[model samples]
Target chain A: MSRSLEPLLTSRYGIEESWKLANAERAGAYEVARQALTTRKPEELREEVKKANIRGRGGAGFPAGVKWGFLNRQDGEQIYLVINADESEPGTFKDRSIMDLDPHRLVEGAIISCFAIDAHVAYIYVRGELAFSVARLEQAIADARQAGYLGERPFGIDHAIEVYVHSGAGAYICGEETALLNSLEGRRGEPRLKPPFPAVKGAFGMPTIVNNVETIASVPDIVQMGGDAWSALGQLPGDGGVRIYGVSGHVKNPGLFEAPVGITMRELIDDYAGGMLGDRPLKAVIPGGSSTPVLDPRRKVDAPNEDHPLHKWHGQSEIDVPMGVDTYRALGTMLGTCCAIVMDDTVNMVEACRNLMRFYKHESCGQCTPCREGTGWLVDVLDNLCNGRGKPDDVDLLVNISNNMMGNTICAFADGTAMPMLGMVQKFREEFMDAAIHGLPDGVRHDDSVRSMVEGVA
Target chain B: MAFALTPEREQQVDDILTRYPERRAALLPVLWLCQRQNGWISPEVVEYVAERLELSTAIVKGVVTFYTMFFDEPVGENVVWVCRTLSCDLRGGKAIQDHLEKKLGCTAGHTSPDGKFTLLKAECLAACGQAPMVQINDYYYENLNVAQLDRIIDAHAAQGGEDAAAEFSTCATFGAPHGSRGGSVTSAPPPPSREAVRLASQPPPANDEKGEGS
Candidate 1:
């Protein structure tokens, strides 16, 4: 793997009182935004971002420039830019850190992005649970507006710009772009059917562009350094720039680290996160957020050619696979959010699957039948398997439910839930069979007595 | 009794309304304001919000029920949310939830017998790096073990409402000082006393010409 790059996204993380506009400005916050607004045309800025190859960090990994291209900028139609700051994916916390610590960077990015897309108004839909981040972001917007960087004719440009902070009342599905638009409009936080995608008719029946917090936060840097120069920061050809990889669960120093896109899982766990907690042997890792498929180091590559990026680990463990969008996709998983949750050897695979299933079931928006019902059924079987009540065919039943849920929903939520469900069961089939036939191992059974005390909490 | 916003709060509602293009789009903020003034969203408040936003009661109620943060029923002075997602769970979040239940003498999703706290199991709070954390009111108590949690609950129990809500500090190592002008933290104002809310729910005397206040 290449040497770690200098921090771009996280540069302001450790600065004292970085959330303050003055401190952020002193650290060179809005210089690029000012320059871009004064000197660059909207299309010029958009093309630069396209050349930089910055993907959406919220989870989808879609290129920001491509998403911008889809916008129907009809004359006299109000254009809206919505920032997805909902950061609710189970193991992802990078967006929260950015919003909490260096909110001005996000504000600057939003200012430039809105200008680039010809949007005069932007609403940042933050998860209601993150009260602190919401406050910080709101403050930053107010400060930027006061400093003549956000309101009408900001920075003396002819175009007007406005940014507002809107909070979600704790709905995970709102993280989905369309659902976020609905929630912003004070409607039920349910996913809307797509073809009139947010690009064309969004946010009160106007042209809208929704971009993730991290993706927008990269704009100032891309503008400052020039697109191709910024793109060269990544190890891979297509995947450009650094990612704030967040590591949690059984690591000594579990926190966010800024590294190039193709950094390996071993590098993240060992070099960045200080390795496993107490130096325990690695068991498995959810390479991204909870929705991503779990990767077991013990599993070997099915087929590896010399030309493949993962060829060296063919006979050995696949633990050292590079963490990138294409590489993970090549390995039958995704680099969703790039927030890894590491598991040590002491953890139980069955219980872990149950933990994640319960989350997906609780978060399913109920808009689609397959996701609403399939998630619940998966949880029930996992619960049964964990509590020594599993039927012999429950293993097959779990797989069957997961297979049916995939690609069968209005949104990708059902598919995300099924990815991990199927990943764990297939990777650890024997464990599921063992739990089903003989119940969870000695200390792994569900504590129903305690559970009853907290029932209906969801 | 019919719910009515004070003149000042009505002005605040009007300001929030201007931010959105449509009046009904301000429903969430208006609902939040109602919840802040009262302990929870009573039926009367629902009707008042619907009227204020020019939305139907059914539309307002659907929104309230859909989102998790809005409370339809009265809760204790403090609401404690224990995150039970995978990252925290792997780091002993479940044990902390169990401990809180035992200590508070109530199950999750219910207020304690003393009416001091309402314990709820939260989804991933996006603070996994500091695993095993709980959000008390609007402040987050992170990197918690049983002992740390005990001290926090005890302090809140002793201090009571607003003071206690402001007393606990965040474990965030960087950024502007929380609650500072630059950061400007906005927690749900300390809930009104249960007795006051109950009294407010009752109808006024039949002889009164003007109901409560204009």
Candidate 2:
């Protein structure tokens, strides 16, 4: 279904000068922040956001209002709102567009969110490699400051805001909330232990609110339009606002598709992305980012057949399940980042898994032994199996190792790495077995995808 | 060689410090500013940064090594990142890597002989939708082919470009994803099944059958 009214996050993506301050202001950029800052109470703004059911777009989809409530709310301690622009999750490119095409939207939302949480300052810790995005966002921030949209006392309001943008030195883990805080603090970007969550003690031991790029960029809309209107955009009650989905890999017309959170994968592929690249039969789909499990959409995704207790907790099937956090959780996976990667039959599952494993193995912080060691072991075993010299038990052996690694590390990084392996070993076990017992799966030829380069030319 | 930031850059570093309540917070940005000037974060630069932030050199070194962006050694005049991840892999990222390695006379993470280019195989730069994408300094050359990429690089080399990262924007440099010539052609699809594949799908061979001797 087409989105009613204007697209909240990407309303101006296609327009010329959408990123410039003049165009954004002409299109009503900071009006909500202006009104909210001067006319509305901070708590009222938070309530409106709470009513809108806005959730974190940084993968977890944690309700943003609930997260804002976690701020100590006391008068003395300083509160900080960190924008997670470190969009490193594989297959997820939705946030980059906002940073590139519409930086003012984020600036407006960050200002409104700072008011809601009573945070005087906000830091956007951008990914180091995203120098292009950083440059655009920095220019946007400068323009906003020059216009008095930022800095101490805006438009005669008593409230003050100072915006600063920081760059992350390339670490995937920095996308994690605690790890992001650690990196922002000029330390190693390692995930911190929970219990003293970031809401209570974060970013130099202050009560901080960390949000994803899309999550904060979505705030101004809920404020501009009433909360009920925003929530109605969701596929389900309490489903929050629309999500920015990235459809990539093996799919024709692959790009950003904005829709309600619970839109099914089938619709995303066929209707939005123009189906598979050559209309080939699908092998599998990563419903979310690399951290989430893969879905073998060709078969039933019943709960009882799943390899974890996730189904027992929520109890549902995922074959045609709506793509949302709770629905995915019920299906023994997560709706993280909403970066969908569709695989065609020609792909060798073993090599795909290896490509994914190498990411985790390289990204692990070594803060926990299980993650540091377990990831390396998985890579080694996959190398052996995919490169010849694997025992048949290797697939099952991997399953066993992944099971041990899940929930046993300091952070969810271990589980995030393990879940995909679990998905590959469980759903695409035959392919893994083929690599071990025989060789690459039939029809999967020439390990190097160099043929892609030639085909694009010839 | 002196491991010092220029007066204006030092002011930029000091300004970044005011954003955070602590002095240590400026370490990363300071190091980045240094890299922007020096092309790499050398040992003396690292020590200079450590001194500036009041952090131990070991601590600064640890911080530098932890993040991938801060280079320990000099890079080429331009750094090109060819994505090497699942979506890119499926879209032939490996070929782009091989092509760049061949053209630049350097493998991934190596500078070219003329020091004009440094090629790196990066992990998921978050442009999956534009499969087979490369970030050259600041601008993205997405949905690329060997021919199109060759032209882009040749144009840049002919211009004798410096790092455009600080001033680059998508609206300016993203000329077009692919060049005029070429279609996505493929060899005939592999026949659906094979004899060995069919045999392996049968109930797993009893563990005892293939073991014991080994």
Instruction: Report the lDDT of model 1 for residue B94.
Output: 78
Candidate 1 has an interface RMSD (Å) of 19.5
> What TM-score does the predicted chain A of each candidate obtain versus native chain A?
0.95, 0.94
Interface RMSD (Å), every candidate: 19.5, 14.9
Worst 10 residues of 2 chain A by lDDT: A449-458
lDDT of 2 by residue, A1-458 (tens): 32343456766664555778998888788988889998999889998889989768999879888988888745678999999999998988878878877899999999898888888899999998887788889999999989998888875687788778899978999999999999998999999999699899998899999999999998998998878778877865566778787777777656776667666788777766666766678878998899889888766654564564344423333546777787787677788999899887766778788889999999999999989999999988888787677889999888888988999987899999999999888888877888898766545543544124425331
> Which regions of candidate 1 fall more than 4 Å away from where they truly are?
A1-4, A305-313, A448-458, B165-167, B171-214
Candidate 2 C-alpha error for residue A135, in Å: 1.2
**List-wise, what DockQ does each model earn?**
0.18, 0.24
Q: Where is the poorest 10-residue window by lDDT in model 2 chain B?
A: B194-203
- Measured against the true structure, the TM-scores of the candidates, in listed sequence, are 0.91, 0.90
The reply for model 2, stretches above 4 Å from the true place, is A1-5, A73-75, A301-319, A442-454, B162-214
